[model samples]
Target: MAVIGSVAEFTAEEDWEEYCERLEQYFLANNIKDTETEKRRRAVFLSVTGGKTYELLKTLLAPQKPTENTYEELWQVLQNHLSPKPVVIAGWYWFWTVRQKAGQSVSQYLAELRRLAEKCQFGNFLNDALRDMFVIGLLDTAVQKKLLSETQLTLDKAYHVAMSHESAVQQVEEIQGASKQQVNKVKEHRDPQKEKGVISAEGHPMSQMIVSFEKSCVSRVVTRAM
Candidate 1:
């Protein structure tokens, strides 16, 4: 079998929820069943740093060390230490306060909101809350209006509508930009007479004395100023 990717490394610098998500994705891609404790434990062992592994092993005591062999127990123990109830509550606070930032794309902002939602774990209200948060957090009033125009909007509904609307708007902007470029290119093929300020269509040597006239005007202005 081909290796899909390297194991997810979880160090102190990584966020708990993000690390868990990475691990989950890696597991899914590799067909590593989480229910298989031995395989999960082996994967976890390879993924974590030596120190983190040691810490996990030390969570159990005496003869009970062997009993803590399962990956579920290890995960639960890590959760207890790394992300207890207070930490999870703080995650929810941050989730509620998150707003789409300036210069952040719609897709990026949406992906971030979804990650924050995972951390918050809003239970049965998660779907509705996700929709409300997504709609409320958008920086673009036009997109928000388009999403809100729907009589009923769930998270999936809002995501699809917003994505489609944003895509359409982007497409129109791109077309207009391309059209403007073509127009400018056409305009750039200017009349040589205008560029040279000579040989006019009216069939004259088109004012060769223009620069002299301009200099005289400037001289007069300067003389008046002095």
Candidate 2:
């Protein structure tokens, strides 16, 4: 039999929702079945969550023992302790105030918007809220204008348009930067005066011209003398 993947122990700094998601995936991968009462699953969770986490869970449960609880009850207890639901108004305040930060990409901004929106409890209007926030929060005025100009714009469409615009802008900058570098290299290799006339062995253009003229005069005088 192949070795099953292991789950990492949860830490205080980690997001409880994300950690639970990964834990569920690990359970699925290992083919650990949860009985109707979730006994097996509950036992596995307690064993795999590490000593410190189990101790924390015991503390959260208080007078109740860990073995007395179902898996769902255990999960809920830990979740509520670690990640209590935020107040709706406070969540909205953050969601409304968020903007695309400097040096942050469109994708990163979108992820932040989603994270903040989770607490907002937008429900059915989630997509609409996300779309509006995404457009207004954009740092690029051109991309914002493009999104606003669209008729009946959905969140999906807006995301596609914004990403496309971001990609195109990056490509143009790269191309222009490369072209400028090539032009500079060519300029460095070329000497305008040398192209027009030969430089003197002494490496001066005016001196070369003067020397040629003097040589010409001397040759004519010598021919006349002859």
Q: Name the top lDDT candidate.
A: 2
Q: For model 1, how does the per-residue alpha-carbon lDDT over 1-226 read when each residue is reduced to its tens digit?
A: 7858765456777766567677767667877765655765554554553566555657543345624556666666667767666567887888889999987777888888888887676889888888898999988787788778888778887787667666665655565565455445544564775656654433332332433444565555434422
Candidate 2 residue runs with Cα over 4 Å from true position: 1-3, 29-32, 192-226
TM-score of each: 0.59, 0.76
| Clash pairs, model 1 backbone | none
Instruction: Go through the candidates in order and give the C-alpha RMSD of each one to the true structure.
Output: 13.5, 15.3
Predicted structure 2: lDDT: 0.80
lDDT of each candidate versus the true structure: 0.66, 0.80
Clashes of each: 0, 0
How well does candidate 2 score on lDDT at residue 99? 96
> Which residue pairs does candidate 2 place in steric collision?
none
By summed lDDT, the worst window of 10 consecutive residues in model 1 runs over: 201-210
**Model 2: per-residue Cα lDDT over 1-226, one tens digit each:** 4738888788878898998998888777877655753787898889888898899988988899898998889999998988898899999999999999998998999999999999998999999999999999999897788788889999898888878777766655565565456545554656677654654233444444544655565555434422
